[model samples]
Target: MQTFFIGFFGLAAVVFAVGVFRTSSMMRSALALLFSQTALGALFLAMQAEFLGVLQIMMMATEMSIMAIFMVMFMMDPGGLGGMDMSHQKRLSLLAGLGGVVLVTGIAAYTQWEGLASATEAAAADEQIRQLGRELLGRSMLVFETAGITILTAMIAATAVAVKVPEQGGSHES
Candidate 1:
């Protein structure tokens, strides 16, 4: 059952990832992205990483909701009005994607995976998660905080730029 669900979610993620790019409407694309992220989270849960999986799903839900709201509010045709075309430089993009796949495959085929063999013992799931939390929040706290602040700053700047300021004497609302 677990194996089946893992495979299902993996396949769903791939399909939805494609949908993210192929959908004409911004809202549809955002939904696709949300679904793809959720599918990936399920995949992680199937692999027994509960914390990361749940966090991924929750984060993506909030992010996608905000994204869809922004798209609807700011975009001229959030629904793609009349089937807006989305792709650009298709041939080059396809070639680049194929090249990336080939490169990654070659690397995976040649690499020696020894980390699993070096496990100290059969550690419990929760302990492993704790170690991950320590690694992220302890050793990498600065890096994580920097990334969070950077993203927040960017969002603030983008909102400021997108917002329409009413002129002093003019009534902006018609």
Candidate 2:
């Protein structure tokens, strides 16, 4: 079962990577990235790292959905799936992305880490999960509330920028 789960995750990751690279539409790329993150989360779960997996799903899914919606709302010809206009900005963006990939790959290659000898032998695993949940819901309540407020503010700001208010009454121009 574990091997099957791993294989499934690996296939999902490859498909998402192809989508990210081959898609011309920015929205499609974003969706692909979301799927990639989701697959990674599932992989973590399959490896018995539940907490990180849940966090990955929550944050990446929410962020990608929000960005995709906003892009569709704000971009011209949102439905058009044309190739991206590769300008100097796009070139720069690609270079930055490449640099980030190299950096992360390097870090991963250099890191020396060992996995738990026995997953079942971990002390207080259940208690640790409970503690984490308590901390997130209790001590981190304010942080979560603030994040909601920030999202609300961003929505209002986007609306203000995109929506034009009509004049209250017709006025004669000089």
Pick by TM-score: which candidate is best?
Answer: 1
Residue-level lDDT tens digits of model 2 in 1-174: 988998899789778976876665778878899999999899978766778788899999999999889878877755445655534576788889889989998988887645624445433546768877787789998898899999999999999997988767557543
Query: How well is each residue in 1-174 modelled by candidate 1, as lDDT tens digits?
Result: 888989999999999998988878999999999999999999988877788899999999999999999999988899997887867999999899899989999998888877546653435679978888898899999998999999999999999997999667656555
Q: Which stretches of candidate 2 lie over 4 Å from their true place?
A: 1-11, 25-31, 49-95, 112-130, 167-170
List per-candidate RMSD values in Å: 4.5, 5.1
TM-score, every prediction? 0.75, 0.56
Query: How high is the CA lDDT of each candidate model?
Result: 0.90, 0.80
Provide the lDDT at 150 for model 2.
100
Q: Score residue 129 of candidate 2 by CA lDDT.
A: 88
